[model samples]
Target chain A: MTDATPSALSPLAIDVRGARYVYPTGNVTALGGVDLQVKPGEIIGIIGQNGSGKTTLTKLLNGLLKPTAGTVIVDGVDTAKKSVQEMAPHVGYVFQNPNHQLFARTVQMELEFGPRNIGLSEEEIAVRVAEAVEFFGLQDYIEEHPYRVSFPIRKLVGIASIVAMRPPILILDEPSTGQDHNTTHVINGLMRRLRDQGTTVVCVSHDMPLLADVVERVIVMKSTEIIADASPREVFADKTLMARTNLQAPQVTEIALQTVVPLGGPVALTPAELAADIAMRTGRPAAARTDAVG
Target chain B: MSMQAALPVAMIPGNSIIHRINPIAKLVWVVGYVVLAFSTQNIVVLYSMALFALLLAPIAGITKPLLKGALILVPVGSSLLALQIIAPAVERPWTPVGEIGPLTLYGDGIYYGFVLLGRIVASLLLALVMVMTTHPSDLFTSLSKLKVPYTLNFMLAMTLQLIPVFQREVGIIMSAQKSRGMKGKGFSAVLPSFVPVFVGAIERVQQLSISLESRGFGSNGIKTSYRQVRGRPSDWVIGIVGALALGGLSAYSIWRGTWNISSDIVFSPLFVVVTFVISATLFFGVVLFAVFLSLKK
Candidate 1:
């Protein structure tokens, strides 16, 4: 598919268009005529205040809910037309609660649950379970009741539950919620790991700083529609978009934007990126990482 | 406590004698104990048994919060006591305030109500001890140990596991509703919260279950486990206690006059009320434990 063609025919992870939803009881529309496209192997962050249709949109992506109007395509398959089981091998969804999806009596049962569902043989299930358990560092709690352990460990079980399926795209809704610093770091590390494996990561979270660190592009939703979709640095750079969508720039980004006056000009939103640029102007530091953001 | 709230974690780490015992064992023990308690109108034996059961609270590591869960039955427990004491005769019953209509039928109604009420308390306290001491996972293992189908065991495990998830989702949906001006006047306001929580939970279940299916939950194959349950010495001790408790009850009941001329209450408002309250407590306890563990950070 060409760049000009519709995302449905292409290799995009998520392709949504004109999606509108009004609940059976409510007059207000939860989602109204939304359109978006996210490419494969990309990390996209969804940021919005409460009631901005973030969760609703994710539900559409996973086929958990059918749209009142429009269609959502994940990996070119129409989500609305298929059941979650049919769409599951390509797209994995993690709910906010780690406990809900956990069905096994023990942690090992939790991980094996997904692969077995997707028609993998016994040997294949075993291999995937072993690899995922080791990868997520869930070796110790594999024998305990998931509910008997710490909160982060349960969250890990939830993630491992999804990861065992080995989907091409992973959608984490509010993953950082209720997580501590160490847990967040572990999640951050997991995201990088997933990215290296070429799985598209779509995360919905209110943690602006954390999302900024992991996500390349962010879609800011406000009141049932897309308000801003841009690179994290570029989107955070725009003050007008931030105010309109009720998305606050990271404290550090705001600090840099207000304090730095490089070449007697206003500062950039992502100071870390701008800092390296400034240093490059003077003399590029050999130690600085210069990965591109799109 | 609110219906939707989950209990805190490790408040009951699920490692007690009562917890290790089988649920069937526990259930049978309570039934048997009540029969023993009523073998005679011997208040001494009944009170002593109550005291013994109370001792189990400590041995089972049941918390003050858990005992507080029992406070839910104070009204029913007290009312049942009052009814047993004040009732005229099983052959012909009458109420003090004839117009009030609160006093129930004559015949076997009050007698059965009293017996059932006592049984409920005894059974519930036993259940509480089991839950406080045993992890739901262990309970599941015990079920599988008893040769229950994997399907039934899986459903039970899913229900146990998803309890906290639904509970927290209640909070999330409540907040989301509040933020969206979903506060309706009177009972409708509850519907807004219910809709979100209900719809959210159902949605999550669908999503998660689908994810679970992909993981091979129902296949006819031996699956691996993250946790192991063994028949330790503690389990044997629990088995002994559970067995002896019921056996003694059966013996005592046979010797009692009341056991033969049986008439148990089938339904009462208070009985319904009592059940509603107890089930609610158990539900909250499960969910709360889940939330506490999930949100530990």
Candidate 2:
């Protein structure tokens, strides 16, 4: 039941058993015997220092690039044997840079491309496009070219493109990067909606507290293999593991672990819970963390 | 280098039969066909070659014909008009091509001049069609497979990739200057736009060379390609047809003594009327189909 011990009972979304990959051009051994499992309908946080092969794993799951050595399965489908298009309906990946994948002249076209490719009828595609537009409040700029838009708007365009497709397993590689306060809220809200619809979301990010509050589980990879895989409470609990990977525990978890203010065990790793816990423990409470960045 | 998402010569991803043929064979066939066009002025042969090329369009999944043909079209149109216009003006030095007016004549020199223009258009059109449907990578591999000098293929691939980046940068620089009040007088502004493009282009080339080298390009090893280019019987057939067409055209000119359809050789009223009727018929046939498609779309 504790965060320290990962459960074996949950239904698995993707199962990677002993996966390995190498780049022929003087590769620094990107991944070695990497074993990872994502449970269905769970938000798994994959965190590590840069060059820890997070993006590489994202590619492997989407079948963009096959692993050199082991088996990677998404919803029981083998990745190495399938093409990106074949795996596309199941696994949707939102890449780090928004511009690289955006090819259409307008935001509406960009949103329609994936759905169209995967054989969604025009009426169905229109409905999904409408839903995405409404969700992100992107009505005014839907007709504009994504290139002409501002940075935050472009990021939303990129997200809407992926969200419109509605893939079952979504892997977001640092979705929160280059986003401000309002944009961060929008990203969180998007994830919450996907989670509500039973989409399995995996994310790799640097914003530790924000991730801890959102992800149902966390997996830490460094220098090739997984170092820790557990719920947010457990991953943030070990200050030593966080320090090794150049990450810090959520401030509330840290406060729970370090402070004399006995805010019940691990403080929930969330802003609202942290505020309530602090108010109980220390009468003079501080303001709630904004953007979930404690 | 990544900033340069270059559009390769012909990369329409499809399972079409043309895509399955070896890129080297396709290139050879295209070149052979072009050479064949220059070999003759026989109307029958040229029309046949045109028909063959047109048929291959559907097979190759060639979607952008008018745009690709536009490049050849401009040169062809200018040459035809020039031959028809200028031949009448050149006096004394001009060979008596044929008398059109008391003061005017169609010169043989102009007819010979139009030969170069006609051949260029024919060759360029065939080459453009071939380029549209084949993947750049496939063609490069096939070139290497057919012993087209690996270094040259490498150069070709890199250059093709860089063109799009150059175009995009050109776009960026143009926009930047426009915002800063550059008098964008259409073609006139194009020269000014070149200032940034030229400077940036050189830096990009050097950077690209360095990046390619860093990625272990030109290293000593048998280059292994993930996708292989394989030639087929159809490729050879197209090449032969192209070569024969060119050859027949050249031979007919020598034997029949017909350099070109002379400018001064005016068509009769009856002939002109028939030409107009035929042109109209063809035009309406195409228009009817286009209208139907537009309605469907």
Candidate 3:
């Protein structure tokens, strides 16, 4: 695959072309003939079964692994030409294991690691660190070692460290894994803020509902290739594609499909959306709708 | 960052003589090697000892670790040699070979430097051989069999396990830092990152202690192992032979006063030639294995 020249007027945030990856020792092909593209400021979710190349695809955007057969262009720069360090300012990756990434003595120092590494001025670093701490609600544990904190807080520290770098594109691998509903909601809120600030967010997760609530577009992968890419409504509405990928739509979406769809109501992603759709179908005011199914 | 290799001290699984040797026997062998290393300032003896350890590498299925060990030792041995060459021990009667700037090189200093390098390399390789061949569980069990305190054995086992885990954590942390734009490389760059690793390690230790207590660690009742390894006849033979050879060498070196700095090489010409031949063979064997591995990749 040839290198893509993203035009200045419509610059792509990420462009992957026929990327392939094979593990060094086992020679197992993690990704094969995969092509994907993300537009600027888009909230994208990548979903796939285990070994379906979701994490591998995300890693390619940040120069973590070079494509064996093709090219990955991030922010108009060829990822092959940049080291992970060089790619730091443009793309930030939060690994699944927070303990693996948190290395600073305190939460503040951990948050500052990225900004300091990128050579931000002391004042700018201080500002970003302060902002990250506040944004992540880390004020109480700012002075404490990240390891001494709870796992969920450590995960926040990991996210904040990357966020402090202020990369234009953020790739989170399994951000909602092992997280409770409240913590996932907090992460979803952060994702919304990042998107509102014009940062393109790419998340890979198995949490169907979180993806449904957060991402504008969902990309379904299978056998190392993207098989479906569409809006959440369109993607989740396709029962065959979801089944082939071993995925289920958000539970509320499923409930809406089962009860409301037969009754000529729209497919809803969230309970509120389902409620609104059901209210509209029943000729009732949306705010006065008591129960979605009723 | 490239995936870090497995821990250097972790045992490489195999069924060779070195691997089959009882861990207690290997520990005894390491002790004998250390004793012999310090008992002689003879360069020939030290090189032969190091060569023997290198020869054991292939048999133990740890050629990769041996190469890694050599890489680590080279810089350290060179620096020590350089320090000795520049500044000979002040108490020694020195014959000056040459002068570089304000530094004077002496024959005794140069010879002693080689002796020191050899001693360090030999002991290091011997220890590496033991560590690479024996599993931590087996080592702890052997220590138990030797009547070492259970608490001490447990500590040793935990230390061995934790070192690798911490190494992996350090790698992950470094990768995280690199992604954050850390430009500095090597130990100096990694020094600041150690704080988190230490903190993480402390937390892990606390959790581990709780888990251990719950699992009946330090219990008064008799404990049994899942895999029992009794000392075989070969273990006794190897241990006794190793002890006798090391003891004989130490006695001979003391009798000949070769433990101190000596002007003459002590080994016979034929013995020196054999040592050189064996060392060369082992070195080339390692090189060939590396070449094959690269080609396979």
**Which fraction of the native contacts appears in each prediction?**
0.00, 0.00, 0.60
Candidate 1: list runs displaced more than 4 Å: A1-10, A261-294, B1-297
Q: Docking quality tier of candidate 3?
A: acceptable
Tell me, by TM-score, which candidate is best: 3
Model 3 clash pairs? Answer: none
lDDT of 1 at A73: 83
Query: Which residue segments of model 2 deviate by more than 4 Å?
Result: A1-11, A260-268, A284-294, B1-297
**Structural similarity to truth (TM-score) of each candidate:** 0.48, 0.50, 0.79
Give the alpha carbon lDDT tens digit for every residue of B72-161 in model 3. Answer: 665566555556555665466755565556656554455676788898999999898888888789888877777788889888888888
Angstrom error of the Cα, residue A155, model 3: value is 4.6
- Report model 2's TM-score to 2 decimal places: 0.50
* Predicted candidate 3 versus true structure: per-residue lDDT over A56-79, tens digit per residue: 788788987888888898988888
Local distance difference test scores for all models: 0.67, 0.67, 0.79
Per-residue CA lDDT of candidate 1, range A18-49, in tens? Answer: 88877644256888989989887789999998
lDDT of 2 by residue, A173-288 (tens): 78888888678777887887787777888888988866876888888989877899988888887778888988888777777677533534444686676667667666877775
Residue pairs in clash, model 2 = B10-B134, B22-B230, B22-B231, B36-B246, B39-B246, B39-B249, B39-B250, B40-B249, B40-B250, B41-B249
